[model samples]
Structures are given as C-alpha cells and as structure tokens.
Target: MSENRLTNILVPVFAVILGIIAGAIVMIVSGYDPIAGYSALLYGAFGDRYYIGETIRQVTPYILAGLAVAFAFRTGLFNIGVEGQLIVGWLAAVWVGVAFELPKVIHLPLAIIAAGAAGALWGFIPGFLKARFRVHEVIVTIMMNYIALYVSNAVIRSVLSDQGFKSEKIHPSASLRSEFLQSLTDYSTLHYGIIISLIAAVVMWFLLEKTTTGYELRAVGFNQHASHYAGMNVNRNIILAMVISGAFAGIAGAMEGLGTFENVSVKAGFTGVGFDGIAVALLGGNHAFGIILAAVLFGALKVGALEMPSAADVPTELVDIVIALIIFFVASSYLIRLVLTRFKKEGK
Candidate 1:
C-alpha cells in the first residue's frame, strides 16, 4: 500500500488499541477484571445470532448519520444540525407513511423521498446563510437543531396528540422490515435499512471518486477563492453539498421511523445519533467504507455495554470513557508517534 493508505489504516487501528489498553488499566484500578469485562462485552454483542443481528441493526442509522457529517466535512462545511434535520425528516417520513394508502412500492419510496426533502430543506438554510451572508455554518446548524426539535414536536402534538408523544404507526406498505432477515437472525430488528445504508455508502463512494461535480466540490472545499477564480460556482456547490448531506441524515431518520421505532416520538433534545456521527466520521477518516467499519465498532460498543455491569461488574459508562479516549488518541496521533519514536530510540 501507498504511504498515505498505510497511515490512514494504522492511525485508527493504533488508536483503538490504545483506547482498549487505557480502558483495561481503568478496569484494573477499579478492581474489575479487564479480561472478564471485555469478554462479556464481546459476548454480549456477538455471542448469539440474534445479538449479532441486533448490532447490525443498531449500526444502520449510524452509517447514514456519519455519511451526512462526512459529506459536509469533505465539502468544507460543518453541519452540526444533522440532529435537527433528522428530526424533521423523521416527522415527514412518519407523516407520509401514515397518511398514504398507496401500494407498497409507491408508498415506501414516497415516504423516504419526503424524509430526504425535509432534511434538504433544513440543510439549505445553513448553506444559504454561509454562502450569502458569510455566516458560520456551525452556529446556524446548532441553533436550527433545537428549532427542529420544538417545531416538530409542536406539529406532532397538534395533529397526532391523541397518540401521546408519538405519531401513529406507519402503514405496513411503508415499513422497511424484512421478515426473511428477521427470521434469519431469530427475530432481530435488522431490516431493509441496512440495505439502504449499504446503497448510500456505495453512492457516496462513486460520487466522490468518479464524478466531476465531486471534484469541483472538493476543489471549493480546499480553497473557495481559487475555485471561484477558476470559474467554479463556489456558492452553488456549498448549497448542493449541504443539501446532499442533509438528505443522507434525513434518510437515517427514515430508518428509525420505518425500521426501528415504526413511529415518531416527541423529544426534548437532540437525538444522540447525530453527535455520535461526528465521532464516527472522524474515526473513519471521512471515507465511506471507513465510516461503515467505524459504525460497526460503535454499535458493538453500545450493545456490549449493556452486558458489562451484570456480567463483569463494570459500569456501562466505562464504554463511553473508552470511546472518548479513542477519539482523543486519534486526534493526537502525531504526539503518539513522537512518543513511540522516543521509546524506540531509547531501546536502541
């Protein structure tokens, strides 16, 4: 492999190892057996076919959410409002799914399209602000997230209030469930959403690798002034990138509505998945395949954590600490390498 490829692969792998080691140290200090804790965690996530399927199910939305953040990052925009866009998309998908009486083929695609459109609209706001007014995207997206939460909840309450905090269940035609897959995994919630996530990853890779539009967006991201001087439409690409990113995020929300939860619920704050996407994007180095692997790691961590306390007397929160340490190590990889070099020199 080329040097850049080697670095990309090794950096994350080393970070993961360091994080696990640190977590083990913490476990030892707290008088827990690290081996038992980790063994239980691994078992919890994959000991049974059902557990393995559930881990994949949990990862489905995360892949799309990470894609949303990764896409925006590649295009020189920080889209922190994915949570808000996701909320609106969830509401839109659920509304369409519940209202439509169409056939399965038409209904499912229509609800998904509505979700994407809703997310795109939310993304457009921040993109427009950045392009037209030179406003920073991060602030705008953060504010928009709460706006989305409150507005969506108010709308759901006004219309579907009888359901008490959740919208009506979507029609079977609009659902993403797959009985075959469920049975294969002994009745896990693993659904067609994973298919969607895989398709989205392929699309993202093809777009970024094989398209002139992707090149222009990347050029603009590298240097907007240079791109504009070279006759590229910088402002247009900015808006387009956000729209596409938000569409990915919206589709993630659709997974939750149609696959996992089957309904939309009123929430007081952001969905944790959006924030998790940031970490996933970072750990994945903003690559499509990398994001999938990162999402799987996170999914395993989340699922495995549930069994830690009962099986090994380890707190579930320790997993979060490990994740945070991993992020810290990844971000500080240069320092890590320097320290390793020093140790090698001393050994010599």
Candidate 2:
C-alpha cells in the first residue's frame, strides 16, 4: 500500500486499540471486569437479531452526519453548525409530512427534499458570511446552533403542536419505516434510512472524486488565493460545499423523523449526533467509505453500551469515556506516528 494509505488505515485502528486498552484500565480501576464488560457490549451490539437491527438503525443517521462534516472538511470549511441544520431539517420534514396529503411516492420524496432544502438554507448563512465578509464560519455556526434550538422549540409550540409537547406524527405515506425489514430483524426500528444513507455516501463519493466542481472545491480548500488566481470561483465553491454538507446533515434528521421516531418532539438538549459526526469524520479520515465504517463502529459502541449496565454490572458511561479516548488518540496521531517511526528505527 502507498504510505499515505497505509498510515490512514492504520492510524484509526491503532487509536481504537489504545482506546479499548485505556477503557479496560479505567474499568479495572472502577472495580469492573473489563472482559465481562466488553463481552456484554459485544452481545448487546450484535448478539441478537433485534440488537443487530437496532445497531443498523442507529448507524443510518451517523453515516449521513459524518458525511456532512467530512464534506465540509474536504472543502476547507469547518461546519460546526450541522446540529442546527439537522434541527431545522427535522422540523421541516415533520412539517411537510404532517401537513401534506399526497401519494406515497410524492409525499416521501417531498418530505425528504424539504429537509435537505431546509438544511441547505441553514448552511447558506454562514457560508455567505464567510465568503462575503471574511467572518469566521466556526463562530457563526456555533451561535447558529443555539438559534436553531430555541427557534425550533418556539415553532413547535406555536405552530406545529397540538398539545405543545411535540408535533403531530407524520403521515404513513411520508414515513421511511419498512415492515419487511423490521420483520427480518425481529421487529427493530430499522427502516429505509439505511438505504438513503448509502445512496448519500455514493453521491458524495461521485461528486467529490469525479466532477470538475469537486476539483475546484478541493482546490479552494487547499489554497483559496491560488484557486482564485487559477480562475476558480472560490467563494461560490465554499458556499456550495457548505450547502451540500448541510443537505447531508438534514437527511440525517429525516432518518429520525421519517424512519426512527416518525415524529418531532421537543428536545431537552442537542441530539449529540452532529457533535459525534465530528469524531466520526476525524476517525474515518474524511473519506466516504471510511465514514460508513466509522459510523458503524460508533453505532455499535452506543448500542452495545446499553447492555453493559445490565449484563456486566458496568455503567454505560464507560463507553463514552472510551469513545473520548479514541478521539483523543486519533487527534494526537502525530505522536503515534512518531513512536511508530522510532520503533521501526530501533528494529532496523
């Protein structure tokens, strides 16, 4: 393998191993058996058909959310507001699903489109500001997340809600739920969302790797001044990158509204999906297939964590600590590379 490819593949793997070891140490310190905890975690994630179904369902959204972050990263923009875009997208999808009465084909596509559009618009603001006024996107996106939270809550209470706690459940025609898939998996919440996520991954891969637009976006990411000198519209590509990224995040929300929950409820806090996407993208090396694998790993950990408490008498929080450590290792991969180089030299 090429050195870059080898490094890319090995880094995340090493990080995962180190993270697991650190987690075991923590478990030992906390008077828990690491072996039993991990065994329970494995069983919880894939031991039963039901657990497998749930893990796949959980993985669906993570894939899109990770893609959203990864796409923007490739285009040299830090899209921290994927959380906001996802919120608005969820609200838009549920609104369309509840309000419209149409055939299944029309209704489902319409709701999904509304969600992507909503997220794109949400993403456009920061993109525009950054492109036009040189405002840092990170600051704007962070603030916008709060704006989205409060605004969506208000809209749900005043506009969409009947009882003021959550919006009405979406129509059947607009839903992504699949009875056949559920039956196959012992009736878990698994739906067509996984298909959508897969399709999105393909789309991202084709667009970024095959198209001239993708090349231009990547060039801008590499060096905007050089891209502008090379006759590329740097500003436009930045905006487009964020728009596409937001669309991916929005679809992630639709997976919840149309596939998982089929309704929109007032969230007490951020769903944490967007934040997790940052880690997913980082671990995946910002590649399409890599993100899918990373999402599945994270989804497995999350679903598996539930069983830790019941089966191993270990707190579920240990999984979170492990995840944090994995991210830490991934982020500090330079140190890992340094150690690897020293070891290789010693061996020589």
Candidate 3:
C-alpha cells in the first residue's frame, strides 16, 4: 500500500490496540483478569453460530447510522439529529408497513422508501435553514431531535395505540425477516436487512468515489467559498447532502422496525445507535468499507460485553471504557500520524 493508505489503515488498528491495552490495565487495577475477560469476549462473539449471527444483527444498524453520519461529514455537515431522524424513520416505516395492503414486492419496498423519505424531510429543514439563513446546522438539528421525539410519541399514541406505548406489529408483507437465514443461525434475529445494509454501503462507495455530484459535495465541504467561486451551488449541495444523509439513517431505523423489533414503541430517550454511529464514523475514517469493519467491531464488542460479567467476573462497563478510548485515539489521528512520521524520519 502507498504510505497514505498504510497510514490510514494503521491508525485505526493502532487505536484499537491501544484501547485494548488501556482496558487491560484498567482490568488489572480493578482486580479483574484481563486475559480471561478478553477470552470470554472472543468466545461470546464468535464461539457459536448464534452469537455470530447476533453480532451481525447488532452491527447492521450501526452500518447505516455510521453512514448517515459519515455522509454528512463528507459534505461539511454534522448531522447530530440522526437519532431523531432514525426515530421518525422507524415510525414512518412501521406506519406504512401496518397501513399498506400491497403485495410483498410492492409493500416491502414502499415501507423502506417511506422511512427514507421521512428522514430526508427531517434533514432538509436544518439544511435549508443553514443554506438560506446561515443558521448553524448543529443547533437546528439538536432542536429537531426533541421535536421528532415528542411528535412521534404523540402521533403513535393517538393513532396506533392498540398497545400501551407501542404500535401494532407490522404486516408480514413488509417484514424483512428471513426464516431460512434465521434457521441457519439457529433462530437469531439476523435478517435480510443485512443485505440491504451491505448494498447501501456499496452504493455509498460508488456514489462518493465515482459520481460528479459526489465530487461537488466534497468540494463544497472542503472549501465552500472555493466551490462557490467555481460556480458550484454550495447551498444546494449542502441541502442535498443532509437529505441523503438522513435517508441513510432512516433505512437504519427500518432495519430495527421491520426486522428486529417487528413493532414500534415509544422511545424513552434517543436510541444509542445514532450516537454510537458517531464513534463508528470516527473510527472508520468516514470511509464506506471502514464503516462496515468498525460497525462489526462495535457489534462484536457489544454482544461480547454481555458475557463478560458472568464469564470473567468483570463488569460489562469495561467494554464501554475500551470503546471510548478507541474513539479518543481515533479522533486524535494527528497524534498517531505525528508518531509515525517521527519514526519514519528516524528510520531514514
């Protein structure tokens, strides 16, 4: 690999290693056995077919959520409202799935599309305000999160309150469940939603790397004044980027609504997936393939953490500390690069 490529790959790997080392030190200080803890973690993640499937299932939404954040990041935006967008998207998809009566061919796709549309519409507002009024997107998106949360709760209770705080189960026609796949994994919730997430990743890669619009978005992101001087419509691109980013987050919610949960409930607070996505994006360097790897790693850590308390007598919160450290190292890429550069110079 070229030096830059090597750096890109090594930086994240180095961060992960550092995080594990830090976690190990903490474990030792707390009188826990780090080796046993790590061993149990590995066993929980991949020692069985069921665990493997569950790990994949958990990571599926992280991929989309990470992409949502990364897409916005690519276009000079920080879509902090991904949590709110995801909530609305889940509500929209479930609403469509339960309300519609079309054939599977039409119904399933419609529900997914509806979720994306809801997210896009949600994202567009902040983008429009940023483009037109020069309002900061972060502030607007933060406000939108609460609005989406309360509005969704009220709408669900008013319309789909057959259950106490949740909506009715969605129609089978719109479900992404796969009996064959479930059977293969010994009845885990691993569904065809993974296929959608993978396809979306590929699509994201193609769009960003090979398309003119993608180039324009990146250009504006890197230098909005320069892009404007080049005759690119910076404002339009900003809105488009946010809309697309929100659409990705919406589909992530679809995975939960149509595949894992099969129903929508009133959320007590923001789903941590969107917030976790920020970490994933940072760790993955905002690249499509990197995002996939980061999501799987995160998924494995999450599933594996459950086993830590019982198997190794270690608190599951240790895994959270490791994750935070990893994110910290990833975010401080400049430090890692400086160390590498220093080593290279000394070697020369």
Candidate 4:
C-alpha cells in the first residue's frame, strides 16, 4: 500500500518536473531567459494579495470543471459535452438572474440550482442514448457540444438579448459579492465561490468513497459485465453518472456567470474549460483531492501567463507550450515507469 501510494504521488510530480525541464530547453533554444520567465510566472501568480485573489478566482471554475471530468472518468465514461453543459448552465443561470425578482436569500441559490439542472438535462441526452441504443458516448458528446454552442448563441440573439450581444446584468440581490474582502484587496471579483469549491470537494470525496451508490458505480466502471452478472443496473448507473458529471460542469458555468461575469453573452467561442478538465482529471488521477490540487496548478499557470509577457518579456504562449508538454508527459507515463524501474534495479 505504501509503495502504491508513493508511486501515485511521484508520477504526477515527476511528470511536472520533466515538463518544466523540457519547457526550459525550448525557452533556451528560442533565445529567451528561462529563469526570468519562470520567475515572472511565479510572482504573477503569488506575488501579492491581488494575484492570490485572482488565482483563487480562476481556480473556482477549474474545480468544478475538473470534478465534472473526474466523476465521469470514475464511471468509465468520457464526458466530452462538458463545454456544452457549461454554456447551457451559464445561460440558465443568467436567464434566471434577470427574469426573476426575489430576495437575495432565494434568488442566488435558485439561479445556481437552475443552472445545474439545465446542465444535467443536457448531459441526459447522450446518457439516455447510450443507455438505450448502445451509442458511443464520445461521438454523441462531441455532437452535443456543437449543438449546445449554436443553440445557446441563438437563444442569446433571439430571446435573451438586451439590445446588445449580452444579457442584462444580474440583479444586485443575486450577485455573489465580497464587500469585506473588497475593502481589504481593492474589490476583486473573488467571492464565496472558493467556499463552494472546497465544500464540493469534500462532498465528492464522501460520495465516491463512502457510499453504496459510489461502490456500485465503481463496480460498473471496473467491469460492466461482472456488475450486470451480479444484478447491478448498469444502464441506470451510466445515465446517473453522466447526469452527475454534467451537474458539476453546470456549477462551474454558474460560478463564472454569477460570480465572475455577472451576465450571459453571445459567446464568440467555446470556453474550452470542459476540454481542459480532461487533462486536469488525468493529471490528478481522477481523485477529488487530487483534482483540487491539479486545478490550482492549472489556475496558477493561467493567471501567470497573463503577466509573463508584460513583466518578463516572455511570450504568453510559452505557458501553453509548457502545459501541452505536461499533458503529453502525463499521458505517456510508461516512460516514467521505465526510468523508475531502471533506477530501482541499479540501486538494488
């Protein structure tokens, strides 16, 4: 058990280290100061209170998005529709925010719940198809993504438009603001979403590791044939897994709309968060705690990329190159295992 635990931790750590080393080599070949670039990246993400708050803000969506992918992965499903689910969640939350007039106590939670429900419904389509028709979830999810994008844009233009490419601002009552924190850090948009994310992590961990339903889901994931032979309802579990995953992605969208953007707009492009979540889920080993750690790392990279070019004269795109390399290294873990085994044999 200890060896397994050590291997689990070392895999991601070594992958990240190798990725950074590869990134440094690329930077040197490109005539850039790798040390300075990395220094700027670090400072930009954690140099001061403002950057810390921004990092937290960026991490909010990543947490939920990572959870979305990780949850589906646990059930042996690939949820490529998280991008669409996120968009629909944003639309639902913003629509509720503008269409209703209620007290703060009722309005905010209502909008958030509605957003999650919308996302779950979107996820249900592919889930139902897969359960009933043996459809490939990958193809169905990819198609659903495009459908969600176009349909969401149409809704914004035709029904939800407010004389612009955006919806009306959410009512102040429903806004997730932090006036106390604002007085301390000059009014950053970081709010109570961090708390939501932390709570979600705990809840997911409990649900997956400490519940009968979670055991059934994992049994189905490990061997659907065996699960069915043992009398577990595999089809229902599949549908439920996708719906739960979509609900998490929907919460990510709700956080972005209500806590960050405060409104919905005609998205000129996909958020791409759903796709990123795949990499996050893989890097984190699809564990809830691991996902949170992975999300924070990715969030730091994103926040730091903005300041790298301006502060250190490195191209912002360098961060993208580094992230890509990290993903590649993680996906190709066989190389790392080979190296580790060689070292162990030599030491012995």
The most accurate candidate by lDDT is 2
Q: Which of candidates 2 and 3 is the stronger one according to lDDT?
A: 2
TM-score of each: 0.96, 0.98, 0.98, 0.97
lDDT of 3 by residue, 190-235 (tens): 8888999999899888988899999999999899999999999999
Show how many residue pairs clash in every candidate, following the order shown: 0, 0, 0, 0
Q: Once superposed on the true structure, which residue ranges of model 2 sit more than 4 Å away at CA?
A: 343-348
Better of 2 and 4 by lDDT: 2
- Give the Å shift of residue 208 in candidate 3: 1.3
| Top-down lDDT ranking | 2, 3, 1, 4
Regarding lDDT, does 3 or 4 come out ahead? 3
Off by over 4 Å in 1: 337-348
User: How would you encode candidate 4's per-residue C-alpha lDDT over 180-222 as one tens digit per residue?
Assistant: 7666556777877778877877877888899999999888889
Please provide, for model 1 over 226-290, each residue's C-alpha lDDT reduced to its tens digit, 9 standing for 90 to 100: 99999999999999999999999999899998988889888977878888888899999899999
The superposed Cα distance between candidate 1 and the true structure at residue 293, in angstroms, equals 0.7
Assess the local accuracy of residue 23 in candidate 2 as a C-alpha lDDT between 0 and 100: 98
Against the true structure, candidate 3 reaches a TM-score of 0.98
Preferred candidate (TM-score higher): 1 or 2: 2
